[model samples]
Target chain A: MAEPAYLVASDSETTGEEKSSSPFPDIAIGIDIGTSQCSVAVWSGSQVELVRNTRNQKLMRSYVTFKDEIPAGGVSNQLAHEYEMLSGAAIFNMKRLIGRVDTDPVVHASKSLPFLVQTLNIGVRPFIAALVKNMWRSTTPEEVLAIFLVELRAMAEVQLKRPVRNVVLTIPVSFSRFQITRIERACAMAGLQVLRLMPEPTAVALLYAQQQQQSVHENMGSGSEKIALIFNMGAGFCDVAVTATAGGVSQIKALAGTALGGEDILLNMMRHLLPDMDTHFSTRGIDEIRRMGLLRVATQDAIHKLSSQSSVQIDVDLGNGRKISKALGREEFEDVNWEIFEKCESLIKQCLHDAKVEVEDISDVILVGGCSNIPKLRNIITGVCKREIYNGINPLEAAVRGAALEGAVASGVNDPFGSLDLLTIQATPLSIGVRADGNSFVPIIHQNTTMPVRRDVIFTTVHDNQAEALIIVYEGDEKAMEKNHLLGYFKITGIPPALKGVPEINVCMDIDASNVLRVFAGVVMPGVQNPAGPVMEVRMPTVDDGHGWCAEALNRTYGSTLDLVTVQKKGAH
Target chain B: MYSNGVGHLPRSDPLRFSFLHSTRLENPPQFVSFRIRPGPAIRSSLNDTISERPAMSFYELLGIPETGSLVEIKQAYKQLARKYHPDVSPPGRAEEYTQAFIRVQEAYETLSDPRRRALYDRDMAKGVHLAFTARRRGIFDEQMEEKSEWKSRWQSQLSELKRKSMQKDSDDNMSWGARMRRERNQSS
Candidate 1:
């Protein structure tokens, strides 16, 4: 029940050391929940500890089962190899069912899973079952997630011998806003305070940078010279993120990813081989043959073996008193998984394009993922980009190590890796604009501009005898207000009624260090000597803060009953 | 429900689940009550009659406009309501304030809607009785008159007006104020 392995591994060492110095409350835990497996790691002081399941394995099957009774014999006996058969209740790959409705693409694709998927309508939303086969109870995705997180929280508490409160959960970048909300809600239900949500690829990159900094300190020229690209290809997905160090600051430049990776490649091989066998064998016979998890594992092993070997043979037990064996070569595996390779290639290309860097510009291509160990994948990457791929670190554990490093940085147990001082610039520029007569005014703040920039614009009142003005702010480069999302707006009330152009309102917008915009407005008087007064600072509401600026602006502008008027101002001699 | 656009039956629908009947409670007696209601002292007013009643200073009551700007209208409503809201105001004045606020809200809603505003204006011009029922019926009738030539003509005129304003905005690039500001800044 402790936080997952990948979450705390980087910061574990620091925490272990700190434990001896002072008694610090255990607040942070990390979790890595994968489709086939799940792992938890907890940080105590400077030491990082992992909780192993009964099998002495860090990864859980991601399966849950419900029945009238719990399975007897608290632990499974590996000697009998009867673990799968003696189950009173078992569920597998429940993570896949989390936050997914029946209509979700992933849910539909998962129908082929050997497990049963139950459907239930809860309130206004529908939830899908996560486990294969048994359905004793119906639960929402958030509830399933909460079950996992709660277990993790308990594990951490047991290790620390005290209560743990704060947690950081890693999510895929492709996860939508709705999915993130479900995850957050699950964390809340589990009684763990979610301090922050880190993207999986970002965590992996941080880990890699931290390790690279320690080993190749001399090779890294200066605080600003360290630059590397982290390529994480996991079972469910693959992501590529570019990070650079300049002035001791390390920041993510751009990230590109895809849902298809090593898992799909293995699954596709099964799909092809299984259907072909079905043509020759009975459908039920083939079903029995495919039920064995070992067959899938054998196929994956063969693929992994073929990555290094010129050829490999896979022995298959046909379930009955028959056995068949076939030899597969590297070329054969590549041909079978060409589509998946293409997807990885496209994602890498997108990452490069987003970062505005070419393959030649990349100093190092660090590969992290269990699949990256496949010889064929490494060869393909090397051949395509014509660069030697770095595999010095274990692909499977690299993300965990990196996550721990980030933990150390966040908890202030260790100084951020030397790459932290990178003068990295934004990959995409943010623009601020206003809507006028259905069109937008996009002025200054060009995309990719350095951070901490301020811009100002002046405008006259839209109508005559207008005492108050409403200014709507938006983020994005779209020319229409409808297209761009409105961040928020503020009202400048108590303006004296002047001819349409007589009064001037100066609106100044400043994007601070954290990339959040702050707006201020003031009324500028005409030629008369007037005492200077402080400008009214307006507080912008965040999307997560419950109040939306757009709704407020709509209520202020559209809710108003004033009519438009155009009046000429008296000329001054 | 589907025909009415609510779409599909609820999951708890009795017809969908046969087991629901077993869980249902046994028959219960139904209760009925009857009462006689008194008629109002005043008869229902006609839309034309209300429209014919001289246009009161509803905008002034709301502190907005017969021709107020959008900002002015919003500010006036907020200010007037804050002062006269039943919950916020004195109990003795609550009823009067509530009535005034309701009247202002009704007037604003009518004028804010172009179709309602037009019908009211037409009734006022014709000196016709403006009863709520008649106004509602007239609006519904107007909505149902598809492909009416008069509506199309008015739409075309509105579109032309929009196009002209957009063009004028583009043409007048350097306003006097902007030019003066530039000159003044340079001199300073």
Candidate 2:
């Protein structure tokens, strides 16, 4: 039989140049894979359109079930009810577990889920398994995610009637460069090429820009700039961004995010409703899994009800004569999740301070994501911005729609009505630096700096006749190097024999529009334009999985012998 | 990567996508003449222009008067940003547009903050640009003559140090240079 063009998975390494070089331009689709839900959208000629699955549902549950001979994902499978997903055979919430090691507190918190999550706490990947046929079948987060993505790709192909290869996926802003690589790896395994990975709020910002541009044309105005504060809280992450939009270009001024989200609220509520929930679910037997599922469904229902109502009553009976009943009031729920709400407020303030934007100057306040409808979250956002929420966008669909617009714009598509004339100038969400000056993070490119940027800093040897220096790159906002995410490390050698602090080491970091990071280093003596040796240019985030222990190993071996100190004062750029 | 001539620009295009290309000149003849002039003189002249130069004032880059209001500065920045951002620019000239876009952002970054802008203005009045205070670039720029001048200066300085050390050695036969060499050898 001849191979079906739509069914064959293409090579994963095809780049944008190659895609554009082809005769027929391939318009990449936009996908938002949320922690609890997933949606796909594409630019169909003049406007963005969301694609539906076989059941004609736009938003599908994000999970994969391994109950049968062949595993089935939520994309096409017909799930009877919510309880079915909470069963031990289904593995969900991969967004929280993906790219996180066992030592991460987030992974430790996930141990209470119905599925089996085992951690050794040795700075390695956590062990995740699904109960299949009375046996614990081991699997990885990447594998589960890829399986789900494949189903989505098949459904899109069937609907669009073309070979779907490229995609633009929206991710959480707090995800590290290492986490991004894992997402890319999963996409590759699913036989999909990632064109662009946009942070969720930036994607929403792009959509808002398009809307503002249209409004400006309708009014025939001068296209004055409009600043919008975007707060997105989903099941997995919370992100805040400040954007200034004018003439269809949304320039991100600042961004802040954290891993705290709605999932924490659910867990908190569960613990409150059942005080001994941990001890009860500690033993992962089939009966215990079923009982956990029952309580989880009840608590989730109560929380959803608390969004619209003032109070809710949760009543569930676990087998073995365990019965619990309680009333959860809105005020009580707020008290339970007060820490998460406080963090959200602080993130918004930090973003505003970094962007140099005042709350009164904010023209629009956009609330998006799954948890945006919660009354407490809504009040917190409005209180922080001191403005009513903008109702122009749908909270859940905004991210996917913006992603679709980016996909169309980046694919070199054109529209006669000028709707496709849009752009998003992104900023680095975290500071990128090198470990220097006694384990201090000397940032070369500070957070909130615009893209396609190049900044260099000069450093010198800390010891006399030090021939080599280690350039360990990290990405974070922390002052200490250990608190940041280690991207990569290399050594610069062949320095001329000189006194301490005499040999100049020039380290330059460049981030392109597509967000590719490159670090360049060379040794230059005084008054010499020619470096002592050839320059070394390496792409960043070179460390792979299990990199959590790499920094410790380096410290143990090198012992600060190959240290460097900053030669210039502040604001060297 | 440091070829330092026109020949390297096109060859380096694939590796450093936006770096050299954004700074690529439109007129070939003007670029050649610009490169032929002495480095320090041209650099000093460019620095005085307050635009596209290392010491260029933020006001000039945004095309606003030094006394321009914050609103006026923001308006100018937004206008230029629209004109030069790579995504909105014509596809063929995207690289060239990116360079202007970055300069606009840099100007805005400083001028958008009142405290930073005030300090920058003070420094501008003193004729001491912040760009000159730090040792940033290496030999990666495409200026051949500048590199050669730097090399000659370094060679002359090294020779002067050697000459002074030799003279001292001839006078005392136990110069500090000899002592330092002995210490270095022992340490090694």
Candidate 3:
């Protein structure tokens, strides 16, 4: 069956085995699983076309409803009305909560959902469930996402008349290596082998590169460099990227992203509607779940209506003589969600700064995502970029289209018209480093460095005669080690007890074409032709679930005995 | 884009020349070593390129003159990138194309940055040639043990890089005016 084939493909691909030797390589479909909506697109011989489901829906709702013994997903499930999704049986917005620990503020804020999200406030996965048969059925975000992806795969297969195994999924830029592993695991569960995970904004940049290449062809120009700034804000995350395109190659200069999106806006509006909503809905009774569902549906409707209207009248009723009737103006909605908008502005600014691009040099500003329709966000992005939004691509379908283009390219599909002659040189979205110099993060590969890149940093032991040194790798721009995400940790033994700052411990980080990260470390002393010991190459994100407390545990057990500091280089100066 | 195949060997042609030359000097027997095997066609093609050019400057690798501007550099980079990028290249020559593409990218990276370009210019003026960091291939492809052996041959190359960086640090120690004067003198 296709399920077993998927497991074998994923396992081999994860082991970095080359699968391109087959004469007819399978074309990986591109899937954009948005927080609230999802779409599938494939390169169909001549052009990218969205794969519609049996219901002829191009964009399906992203949710999985637990009913009876089997679960139904949005891809094939028929919902009677919008309120049915909010009835506590549906699990949606798994993208935001997939890899987050229970102590995260995002998880804490998710408690107000109609479904049950119980957090112990410890550094562990949150407990989530869906209402079934008047009882709570335990579930996880990964399980719900896998069920949804399985439905998507089945639908695409039925329409395309082929087994869909490989997929290029679009993920947010803010996702850590651990989150990416979770995404890969979900795809594995769905019997899908992930070929690539393109960041949302970078995918848009690829689409823009194609558009620019086409224009250059029409004009018979030299295909000069065109600098474009992409701002993408979806239902669950916001991302920005600066790219330079020429000759069908989009070189990503920098990327910035944050986990702030439309859900936060809806929650804030819900709070405004009923001040005591959290306390009133704290109890997980059936009546409160129904009331919460009503409020969620009402607020979602108002938010959507406010996109085109000046004011939206929101009225909802709860049991026990509780009611909310309020007028939500566009200005009021914008004011309430000012933090989200502010974050969007800062992400664009930070991306521009990191790219070393000036506003005057930006040829086009591309805004593509679900939230691109928000007037306030549009203004903020345009104001910062000082350019009007590029209108050549669809806001919702841009990412999936780009992913389809990437799928074809990575699959080695050749085209006569040169439409497939495209490449996106990606950049590292976050710094991957190790803890050194007394708990400070020392980045071996800094953020915004180009991909297929390898960089190394030399370090020395902090304690004299220290035989072993711990290499606790983290990913972020944080200066303090605790603030960053701990990817994994390893120990370099047999360092040949030398002075505190004598031996050179080389820590190298490499991100290859497929976005696989491997960390190599060895002890290299001056005047030594060979390393002290055999080098160790470890694939990253080696830590498993509930890894949030590993860093604290490492510090507690070893203290400062195995710490390393950056090696100081001396010269004639 | 890149309909012509002229730039396929535009960059790696000259660098591969120096690489084979250094290999011949450092460890000539390694090419025939049983552990390291290249196909006869690859060996012959590599030998042919050895006589093409002995060494290459970053500017020469990109097919641009030393005085090329940032725009010209970017154009050359884009052209070569389109020709040799792994995804765009024909499937039969992905391995060869990827190596050339990395050289072009590295050349563009060093030349596009003003500070790095100046340092490279200084090194070139002082007759300190830049050796290809062969470790990149070894570190990436585990199946290719030849790369690791090739990396050991370039250990002295790393020391050269270290010395160049030390010179750069001493040059950086000067104040803005002094450094500008030194740069002007070097250029002159």
Candidate 1 DockQ vs. native: 0.01
**Model 3: CA > 4 A from native:** A1-25, A571-573, B1-54, B88-100, B131-188
Using alpha carbons, what is the TM-score of model 3? 0.82
**lDDT for each residue of candidate 3 in B100-127, tens digit (9 for 90 to 100):** 7766787888889897677677767877
Query: What's the C-alpha lDDT at position A84 in model 3?
Result: 82
lDDT of 3 by residue, A332-384 (tens): 99888888888788888889999999999999999988888888988898889
Ranking by DockQ: 2, 3, 1
lDDT of 1 at A161: 68
Say which prediction, candidate 2 or candidate 3, comes out ahead on TM-score: 3
Candidates in order, TM-scores: namely 0.51, 0.82, 0.82
lDDT of 1 by residue, A34-72 (tens): 655556655444444555645676555454444324322
- Interface RMSD, Å, model 1: 29.7
In the predicted model 2, the residue pairs found to clash are: none
